[model samples]
Each structure stands twice: as C-alpha cells, then as structure tokens.
Target chain A: MTAVPDAIDQALGIAPGSPLHALRALRPEFVSGAEACRAAVLDPEETLDLSPELRRAIARRVVAGAGHDRLTEGYPRPADPALAALADGEMPEDFALAALARHADLIAETPAKAGPEHLSALQEAGFSVPQIIALSELLAFACYQIRVVHGLGLLKETRA
Target chain B: MTDTIPQVTLKPLTWTPHLPPVEIEDATPRQLEAMKVTPSAKKVSPYVRTLAHDPDSYVARTVLFNAIMYAEGGLNRADRELGALGASLINGCKYCANVHARQHARLTGTATTSALYAGRRDALNPRDAAIMDFAEALTATPPTAEQSHVEALRAQGMEDAEIQDLIHSIAIFGWANRLMHPLGHSD
Candidate 1:
C-alpha cells in the first residue's frame, strides 16, 4: 500500500505519483511550509483560539459549497445541519456564527454571483469586520482544501 | 465575450462586502483571543478578518498565504500576481480579480489585469497569454492541466521558479476566488 502523503506531499503533489511529473518537490521549505499551513487549519492540537468543532464546521460548509461529491477525494469537511442550511441559502438567525459561516460558503460556491447584499446580510446577522474577515478566510480556505485534495486526488489517480 | 470589469485605481476597490456590521466591541473572549494572534497585515483588510469564526485555520491560511506570495524565493511578486489574476478570471472571482489585477498592474504597469479579468485572454501578450492559459486551465481542471500546461510555461520562457510561482498563484486563487466569491463583490 502507498504511504499516506503528508500535507506538504499532498500540496506539492510529492507522493508516489504527483501529476507534476519529473519535477521533484522544488523546495523542502515550501513543502514544509504547506504542511504547516494545512496542519494549522486542520489539526486539532494546534494553539489556536478557535475550537475544533468550529474549524470542522467551516470545513464542512466549504466542502458542501464546492461539492459534496468531492468527499471521496480526501477533502475534510464536517457534517452539521446548521451549516447545511446556510450552504443552501437559509441563514438561521439564532446561531450567528453558523449563519455567517453559511454565508461565507455561499460566497465561495458562487463568488461571481455575490454582491454587497451578502455582506449586508452578514452584518445584519451580527458579524463584525474581523469576524467577516475570519469567515471569509475560512470559507475561502475550504476551497483551498477541496481544490488541493481534488488536485492531489487526480495525481493519485494518475499513479494508478 | 468581452465583458467590462470596473477599473479601480491603485488602491483597494470600492464597496467592499459589508457583513451585518456588528460592532466587534461585543466580541466574545474567544474572538478577542483569536484577534490577538491573527496576522498583523490581515488586520487592515476586513476580508481577511472574516475568518475569525475559525481562527486556527485563519492563522494557517495567513501563514501559507504569506509564504506563497510574499516568501523569500521561487516566484517573483509580479509573476505571482499575474498568475493570481489569471486564476481569478477563470474562477469568476471579481473581488480577487480586482485585488490581484491592481497588484499585477502595480508591478507590471499598464493594467492588462482588466483585460484578463474581462476574460479577454486573446488580447494579452504572448507571455502573459501563456500564463493565463496555464492558470485558467489549471484552475478549472487541475488534473487535465498538468503536463501540457507545465510544458507551455516552459515554452513561454518561464524558468522553473517562475513556473512554480505561477502554479501557486493560480492554485491559491482557486481557493481564494471561492472564498471571496462567497464573502462579497468587487465591480
């Protein structure tokens, strides 16, 4: 069996059969850098103020926004009803963070279709400037993880 | 299909997405704690701060983001910005397109960033066009975009570092466009 690729290996496509072909991991620092990035986001043991559940929730919404079909591609996402609701367009008024995160996912899935209205909605939902920024980054990061997994997944397929 | 993208000057675009406008003064202890460790540069952009819901990932992303675009080596800022513009264009991320186009314009001058954002790849110079071609293809379809796209970069006189930088720029936007698209609008 092939060894599970590390975060750097996955991001840089450095495992058994990266699609890059012929190019070794360009810089070890880059690979480690990417690994640290992924771990910081996904790892539960890190020194972050955000809880793991919230991180997973954001991940789930991001994956849902991008496409649930990608779950098989090694994308990490959480499973939550509140987040699911937001992904589809319904932001619950009570749980502001979940609603905000859902809004962020919608922006991720349909960025081109987004407008000030969405932002206004978040404000209405009680998100602040920093909160909005955080939500945006996490929502955007969901795409990053999904895209990275999808890209690396393709490389894994090529290895076959 | 020549759509017109709004041309903002050499500054952050107008009308950023306005979330519910909750004064952060009421922020809970967790939010405040996250704020303390959040990247200092991100403090300036409300967009980056939106990730406060998931602070750890926020820090991770910031670190990765800084390293990718602002790190010591590999791709230069200009080429990286060009790659970002290309990916943003393909991903339909007006916010990212606007932001990176302005960045690209700052480095290379002559805002072809608008042209690329408008999806008018045909209007670009050969080199810029090639970078766009590769970035878009990679963004839209990474697996299908591998070998040939890399080769095309080579054909465009891109050295290994430039090619790598271009790939990171494009790939990162694949995520960035998704993120910003969900958060707000640009034009």
Candidate 2:
C-alpha cells in the first residue's frame, strides 16, 4: 500500500516515490508523529480560549520570524486585522495578543532569555493556565516545524 | 526558588516551572491519560505536570519525541543522543542538555559531552565534530545547514536514513528547548 505523504513531505516538496520520500518512508513513525503534532497544535480537539485562527496567526508569525517563509506561504491571510498584524510580525494593540506575540518571538528567537517574568506577563494579560500552556506548545511546534523543514530542504539539496 | 537562573552545565539540574503545575489530584481524565507517557509513575516532576495543563499537545509531543529519539534502526542510539545533546547545547536549554548529556555519556563516554560543555568542538573525534557542527548549523534560526553538512555526514559514512534520524533528533530538541527553556529555569 502506498502511504500518503504528510505535511512535512509536502512542505519540502518531497514527491512520492522520490529518493527523499523513500528516505522519509524509512521512518514512518516520525513522519506520522510529526503530522499528529501539527494537528494537535494547530487545531486541537479542545482549544479552550485559544481560537484556531489565533493559533494559525501565531504559527505564521513565529515561522516567518524564524525565516522559514515557505511554512507560512500556504495559509491565507487572517481576516481579522489584529491577527493579520500578528501574522505580519506586528504586535497587536490588544493586551493579550501583544503578550502572545512577544512571547512567541522570544521563544522562536532567544528562548534561553525567557524567564518567570514572561509567564507572569502572560498571566497578567489574562491568559488562563491552559491557554498559556497551549500557546507555549504552539510557539514550540512552529520552531520545531521550521527546523525540520529547513533541515530536510538542505538534505534535498544535498541529494540533488 | 532563588531568583537566579542556572547556566548550562553537564551536571544534572533541577527545573522549576514559572507557572504552577496542575496538581495530580486536580488533573482531569484527559490530563491523566496524557501523563501516562510522561515519567510520572512514581512522582511526577513539575515539568511533566506543567505540560499536562495542555493534554492533547502534551500527548502528541511525547509520542513525537519518543519516535524521534528512541525509535530503533537508522542512527544508533548513542549518536541520536549526541545529536540531541548538540542541539540542546546550541539552543542553551540547560535542562535538556544535562539530561541528554547523561544519556550520551551512559551510551558512550563523557569525552564528547565534556568537550561540548567546555566549548571545545575541536576536541571531538571527526564523526563527533561533524555531528556537532551539523547540529549547530541546523539549530540556528533560519537554519544554515547546507549540502556540505550532508556531505560531511556522508563522509563519516552515515547513510541518508541515518542522517535523517540525526536530523530528527536535533530538530525535536529545537521544539523541546523552546518549551523547557521558556517555561522554566534549571537550577
């Protein structure tokens, strides 16, 4: 049975039956696990107070900030101007969205520099505990996805 | 908890979460299900409990992480640990680095870990250095890993499958370091 390619394969342009696709096929668990993770982060079964639109905007913001433009290319621009600002790398004027954007940049760029104060800031901005955890996962997943995508792109170049 | 944050070290460290973790007694059924895969059979650590606040993502993360680091075949276990250690080192995730350093040491020896902790990549053997170099490049924002990095691993006799495994090891830590570093401090 031919296994369908997951999001990572699509992002890296790894065509079916190609050498790189076969290389990925060697680790089916990693490929499937990654896609599952993408779903959990991007469109969770329970989003709590964090909406799916906001999550996508945050994902785009972080990935774009990380310079993996390809990852954000497929998502249509958010209809909400505030979310559009976020996807464009501008901090929204809303207190909570601004805090999320700031934290997203910190996690994507210099995570080691983050501290208790950052979490406190999120709390003060009215993010519930679950929401904060969800946002962290979102930021983290974006960073992970970019690294995987970029790493695979390099591998593709190597084989080309 | 002191106000100070810990620096990167090979010594094992304690991680203190900035947010209060969900108490086990207060955990929901879903949270408990996700916590199943976490190292919480005895006493749940603050890190695992903190992650449990978001159950679905926590579950997905644990599955993906295990698949990347512990899946057999392709890269051997030791080099996968080394790849994780290298990425953790570059990302400055002290807790993750300390954990993987011990794993790498247990699997191999402490020479490469010591060299990495001491900022002495030159001290690593050719294969170790190549892995470290590739990990560092791939860990960089925008990821500077090149075809030459792949060729270097190839020169070390790593197959494409093995190299992909190594890449997953390093890349997952990019995910892990973001969470572990930002959500807490190691001391």
Worst 10 residues of 2 chain B by lDDT: B1-10
RMSD of 2: 5.1
| Candidate 1 local distance difference test against the native | 0.58
DockQ: which candidate is best? 2
The numbered model that scores best in lDDT is 2
* lDDT per residue (tens digit) for residues B1-187 in model 1: 2544555364566535445322256545555565663445324345534555555555556566767788677667888888888777767776677778888888887447666545565667777777777776666532236666656666777666556556666667876676666555565
Candidate 1 lDDT by residue in tens digits, A1-160: 2256664354444555444432325444445555666565656343334446555566555565444253423344335665445443455445677556556555555566666677677777776655555556555656665555444433332321
Model 1 residue B104 distance off true place after TM-score fit, in angstroms? 1.5
| CAPRI classification of candidate 1 | acceptable
Off by over 4 Å in 2: A1-4, A157-160, B1-10, B37-42
DockQ of each: 0.27, 0.66
Query: Over the stretch B56-156, how does candidate 2's per-residue lDDT look in tens digits?
Result: 89999999999998887779999999889888877889899889999988888777777777666666789998998899998888688988888999999
| Residue B110 Cα positional deviation in candidate 2, in Å, after optimal superposition | 1.2
